[model samples]
Target: MSADNRIIRVIKGRRPKVVVIGGGTGLPVIVKSLHEQNADVTAIVTVADDGGSSGIIRDYINVVPPGDIRNVLAALSDLPSLYLDIFQYRFNSKDAFFAGHAIGNLIIAALSEMKGGIFDAVQQLSQMLKVDGHVYPASNTPLTLNAEFTDGTTLSGEAEITGAGKHIQRVFVTESDLNAKEPPQAVNQVIDAIMNADVVVLGPGSLFTSILPNLMISNLGDAVKATKAEIIYIVNIMTQKGETEHFTDADHVRVLNRHLGEDFVDTVLVNIAPVPSDYLDHQKYDEYLVPVEHDYQGLRDLGCRVISADFLQLRNHGVFHDGDKVATEILNLAFQVGTMKKRRY
Candidate 1:
């Protein structure tokens, strides 16, 4: 083990159990960094996706969308680079039948059909891929995201909700299968992970579509509220156009608290470093708007312990959280919490 890993083990007497809840491109970046730090990570991925290759597959096969899950699996997999490349490879547009589909998404779809559910399929594939940690879809079945805009109009499906271009008032999830008797609920293992985790993380993903879908599952959200784990919200560096335009960091926290019906977030990680003006390629990343403005007092009023720092990383003319830096802060917080529990006992 590396010195840092050794120190964590020695201090905590075990690997810190971290449950990261979210989906989209940002979730995997942080997951990969936490794996490098030797934290026992469990990624609770959102399955409310209804876009891109995942949308096509879901429409045809009646299965949970696999794009987000596939990315998270790649982040945690210990397979060779060549193997991962092949798995993540997307077919060219000229290949009419397979165009825009990722190899991993196809594999996941096949596995889900064979295994009878997404949870089992992902677990089986995790072993096959030599994944370093656990990956659990927020629910056992497909979930459709529903949103009520500020104008009081409602929409269903993640794609439709996002494309409406209206201010989202609130978001919720429902089973895509209207005939299903039971409401959407996470599996036992997912609940166990949340209840037993040392820290539970939310965000660095879209506030309405990516993060809230998972939490809107009643059982999962309840577990998060009741868990002894210190809940942390990784505030987005930039405001998203269709979702969080003109939103401050406090607005993000406020929305989360409102959705969950409590001020459950114990801490917030705010990126204080400003994005350079006219630096972003707007054509490439049209979804992101301006940098999220700060509201320290507003955050404090929400009962959040705000940690502000230079957590900015500028790459390819886009701004993002420096995963390594964010991971370090998370581990430090986990260590402190673990030590306190040990001392009290």
Candidate 2:
């Protein structure tokens, strides 16, 4: 049966604690659907974003970028739709001073200052926004994403790395400070979430920039490796430019495994549907390259239980994962594995 057609239901009085790790546009959709399914959700977002409004805000405020966290907060929030619309509203380019800044980003930046850190600021905002579940920054501090290209050149910052237009060897992150070489540390609460979760999910975001930055953190990656929870990866439906261009689904899994130094992903959800020819608007959806190719044998070689499904949703000429279908499948996996899978740390 297709994942969407699967008639899975959660038992009463039982909430499967699910921890989602990643950043960028795709993270919120999954979180919202899981929240609707009554799963206890915790989002661990990457802090390495340095582009557009987020980069501008990060430059001036010296706080962890709030864009990803803001989106996740809105997604899992129980607030009225009108309230969230106001929070998500953005200034037009004509308004040069505040152009492109979401009201929610400004609020998060303010709270970060008042709360003495982005982590605490998010906690405060989560309560105020009536967020349905926990939202933790991958690390309490700002992290700079750096990439080494195939030609042996290095670029720092998300924009530069992607804009370099070269094949990537690998990507890593570090504290934005000039003197720091160590990976930014994830907060203890994030580690606790992974260890206590019944399942941990990665991706449907930029494999290197959006997803890997979180896992690149030493403590967080270590916790993910050690956790007893089922490790699931929701592979992106389309390849991203400058990273994962022409990357097969198996190549995506391989990069993730190489970074963490283990075949840590227990399961992978791959989209089997096809995008129509020339369906994407290059001007509007410039970041996407093409549909990701499949390699079931390679995934099996990596020891992943590959779950293929028609999880594609096309809107505004852009491709996105069908959140409801993906969520149902994940909850089914959680139930299949049973709730007793949480590590006894």
Cα misplacement distance, residue 87 of candidate 2 (Å): 0.8
How displaced is residue 167 in candidate 1, in Å?
Answer: 1.2
Model 1: weakest 10-residue lDDT segment is 1-10
* TM-score list, all predictions: 0.96, 0.94
Please, what are the lDDT tens digits per residue for candidate 1 over residues 1-345? 232343344244679989999999999999988888888999999999999999999999989999999999998888888999998999997877799999999999999999999999999999988888899999989999999999999999877887788999999998999999888999999999998888899967999999999999999999999888889999999999879999999999999999999989989999999899989988898898899999999999998999999999989988888998999888888887866642111
lDDT values for all models: 0.91, 0.89
Error of 1 at 162 (Å): 1.6
Off by over 4 Å in 1: 1-11, 341-345
Model 1 / residue 30 / CA error / Å:
0.1
CA RMSD of all predictions: 2.4, 3.5
What alpha-carbon RMSD in Å does predicted model 1 have with respect to the real structure?
A: 2.4
